[model samples]
Target: MDYLALLSETEQKKLLVNFSLMTDSSIFLLNENKELIFSIQAHNAQEKDNKSEIDIVDRDDANKGKGSISFSPNQKDCQRLLKDLYEQKVPFSCSYGHNYSLAGEPLIFHNNFLGVLLFAYPTSSTSIFTSQMKFLRQYLKNLFVCHYEMDNLSEEVVYNYEEFSLLTEISQLLGGILEESKICQIVIEKIQKTIPAKSIAVLLKEEKEDYFYLVAAKGLKAKRLIPEKINTQQGICGWITKIDQSILINTGQDFTSRNLKLIELIATQVGFSLGNIRLSKEREEILLGILDSLVATIEAKDPYSSGHSKRVSYYTQALCENLNLSEEVKKELVISALLHDIGKIGVPEDVLLKPGKLTPEEWKIIKNHPKRGLMIVKNINSFHNVITGIYSHHERYDGEGYPDNLKGEEIPLAGRIIAIADTFDALTTKRPYRKAFTVTQAFSIMAKNQGTQFDPHLLDIFLSCVKKGKIKKIN
Candidate 1:
């Protein structure tokens, strides 16, 4: 498709000069625009060309140069002749002014027109031209076709490499994503760079929903209003058709084929990514069932702690929302809160339900619950992030809490946020030893241990949420 654009000017001029030299016939090369790119005068037309200082007017630049015949053959007549010759698309014989006879041939590749080549000879040399014209025309056509094929091959290589490389990068990126909508957004954005579609959209169907929802939509033509949801029967096709009313616009058949292939590969990758996400969700649901059973056992053992983990999860989720955390991270933090006290399952029922304050010997066993919770779920693959909040919920902010005594920022963020939620629920809920602290009293108590027991910034946010009624009060 590049024609002479991809080649350097020196290379194009050298090519034309060689053709003129080898044939000993004056040659003029014009691109599809009818702009005279090169004009070399060979011995055949030299004497005639020298007779007049010819001023060939350029259609593009409005500058005057030599060669081609003239208001006196005009750019309009020249353009008309080039167009007509291309339509015929074969070597055409014609008179070049009154002094010389010329023949023109179309340079073509795969039914696509590249440009036209014109050879001129003096009228005195016309008798010797018929045989030379046929040979020279065919030779020039063959040469151009060969050059065109090479260009096509080179272009295709670069295109394929870029397409493969882009798809590979996209594949690696999609591998790490788990959300269905996120996968669609990422995949569609990559497709935009390689495809020439007017608009692109990824529509996904949920198993229980009768309509397809638009996941991501983009492109120059994408600004047009598109429905957010479409029923399955909305112009949906399951097969390819070859009807005349088809929406396909083929700018280049081969080029378009390659582009379509790129789209297909990307679509397949997205489908695989979506499939992986669905499977992951399925696995996660199954794992949550197991974690729920474990939490139920712990709650059943200690009635006072009933609904404690669930309340903590609710509060943690509220904090995540107020913090504007990403959905994925928020989801992890919430799950971690629900499973934070699961280690109590390993504590003896007599000690856990002891109706009175425990001694230091019993307190030592209570402190081991966080580490025990870690050991319980540590083997589970999907609960890796949940383990942190489970282990550190009891750890204080200063270097004085729990098995690790991690100071300041050494604690995981999930642990830090869950600590505030866990403490708030504990303070608000009734325990065997004392009545529940009112919301006002709970805040007053937590406010005193801002940095030593809780992260100061996070505690402030918790207080803000309660003030804004984002976290509902128990009192």
Candidate 2:
């Protein structure tokens, strides 16, 4: 929701002032981005005098006219304290001396972590003072959540059916449609419904390009004709592109302030949508790069399993497509399949490469791979959605699997899909102990254990796909 961007500098300052006055403690407010929005001294003159006597510089006074102050928690102890507060998303207090105590509360709005609000106070204060402050913090958090929700509701209520419809159309259009020209057309058409203009145009600047190209335009008279290419210094659109601002010119009729704000909002959304498209591509590339590196490392350790993960990923994706899974589900399945065997990296080389039957102890070690893979990827926030698949891919349909014996629909869909793909590849591809099986041989083996080892329904779909020549081969 871009919580930090929603609060104006003045609003932040006012909040700091109110917090200081109410708590009688010096306060520091930092946005979720860890940027210091502002700080305020205690409203108590006696405390201010005491702080002055101690020679602790009041950054608040020094930056009175500034929009925001960039103050780092330079001390290692303070830094660690802030890190704990951020990670825990809870209020914490620490004492530096008999009299001095530092307390921090994370500011949250609508379940979104917005920032941290730190209070510096005297430890000698009454217990009631601390309790009252805690109550106030809770009150503030609830107020912020309510305020944000009300603001959103107010925005929704402001729009009539036509206005709401136009916004909805634009939002849906911008969601997955990344083509710049198409997006510009949709945005312009939506805006035209609300604003009567002689002409409306969308100009975009390409990466590393010096000029803004007019991508979409409507209702242009000869006198109001826009140039095909606009210089960086030309026109309102050029200036907007140059500085990333949304400007509106009122020429045809008296547009309400709400209407103008809507135009600006649409412009801002357009810019954000374009930026997201680029970021999405970059994120996909980075995800693929990480997957390749991890898969390559796994393949390197097990020489006979080269390209095994990739093939599993391909097969899993094919199975997902055949099942008519959503794009998001297919993406996670592919990632989970590529790294399904990643836990084998932790198994002893001898255990992994053994050409004969393993001892019970060695087999146990092999089973620990899923748990190890979970540990390896658990810290990565992006992998949280797929970690279940990595950890439970070996689980059986009848609850006989390792790590967690989740049965039937209790198992995550990604995990269930990967289990089929993993077993299929293992049976069809030559492992150190066994020769590769033909497609028929693999299917027959899998079908025999369908209700026990695999989801019978998914297995049926997979076998049907293989028979139809949709999935070519395990390799």
Candidate 3:
């Protein structure tokens, strides 16, 4: 017997004894693993007859028969019985054979085996097997009522595993997707597959805003959820939204404004997942915005560098379109290029504005900006993709660069694209140290650097854009 049977036996006697009153009743309970350990005699007081209770029957009494007969429990027999019980499913009926004439059939309820009972009937009373089988049918119905309290443990375990796995997958999905509505829709789709809820929602309490918005919801007739104002105990959904709880309603005559245990349990899980998603998303947004704002501020500090980041951002998007990149990739490229010069925030104002050539040490510090920018953005949960681009934008196409010296395809496509855009914008725009080059002059300078500082094909594409005015001076 497993540990569950042992614990259940101590607390489950009165529950088991109730089945003892049935006419000719015998019960066998199976464990969660389906092992049959004990049997009970509900009413075993009937007498046996002479011709049927002969030598073969009496001799068999000394030991339970090995094949399809009452037998002492062995490891092999236990395993075999467990497998049989599992295959039979719940609420099965079978005869307990004995050598004596008065041996009776019993009903077995299988569900982690709370207890079993056996009832005997005298063979003298009925010779027909149909009458005995009729007695068996009645007991089967009563068995459902007897131990329904124990729960379908095996089924519960299965459902728990499915629910946990679904939550994990949804959490991972949320990590990659940023749109609140889409996140909620995916969550609702996942939940609907497991639970029978007509509608699902994710309500976020923006405490500073002093309002709760329905970020996501599903299964409603309307395309968008109507806003539910947050206050204490307003309405069913309102109360749930405000207090971070789950609400469930089961419609029927017996149900009168009360929550069922099952519904409450499911609601708790849903509410927790919703709240967690809201908080996590809020934190990521705040951090990402701070990083981006700082980078933009740094770029804005010098008049000569004004709109530099934005220009790079625009060119990066144009190049991404030319390359036929996916929407997600293009978005990453835009954000990455926009913040590519964030490391300049760490450079001294004097060095940034210096009209003369820099010393080797100052140049070294300036060169380390990409590495510094990477460190800044990498910590933000939502900007990991942008970090790669910011860190490697200075890398050359001909296997020459600092901060890992990654070259050519070793650099990410986003990084390589930003490198071209950054250099092009730098040449076309006037700086504190140098006059802005004319369009033709900038193109000539870029062409000379092709296959060395810049990717050869990319340089060709850039030159084509110049001739076609796809990339033009911002003047």
Best by lDDT: 2
> How big is the positional error of residue 255 in model 3, measured in Å on the Cα after superposition?
9.9
RMSD of each: 7.7, 27.2, 13.2
Task: State each model's CA lDDT, in order.
Answer: 0.74, 0.76, 0.62
Q: For model 3, name the residue pairs that clash.
A: 25-118, 25-119, 26-117, 26-118, 26-119, 27-116, 27-117, 30-113, 40-118, 42-118
Q: Candidate 1 — what's its lDDT?
A: 0.74
Pairs in clash, predicted candidate 2: none
TM values, all candidates: 0.72, 0.55, 0.53
Worst 10 residues of 1 by lDDT: 237-246
**Model 1 over residues 1-475: C-alpha lDDT tens digits?**
5664532256655655655555555665667666565455664233222234434434322222244322112345455666678678876766645455556777776777777766655445565666666675576567667877887899989988998899899989988888787888787777766665556677777668777677877762545655777666556421122231224445453346566667778877887888888888889889879868877898999889988888899899998998878888998999999999888888898889887989898889989999999999899888987899999987789979897999889988988999999999999999888899989999999999999999999999999989989888642
Off by over 4 Å in 3: 1-176, 195-207, 210-212, 217-219, 222-234, 239-247, 250-302, 317-339, 342-391, 400-406, 412-414, 433-449, 457-475
lDDT of 3 at 260: 37
lDDT of 3: 0.62
Model 2 clashes, total count: 0
> Between the candidate structures 1 and 2, which one is better when assessed by lDDT?
2
- Per-residue alpha-carbon lDDT of model 3 for 286-337, expressed as tens digits? 8667756775678666778888888888888877777768878898888898
In candidate 1, which residue ranges exceed 4 Å CA deviation?
1-134, 165-177, 186-196, 209-211, 218-234, 238-255, 323-328, 398-400, 410-412
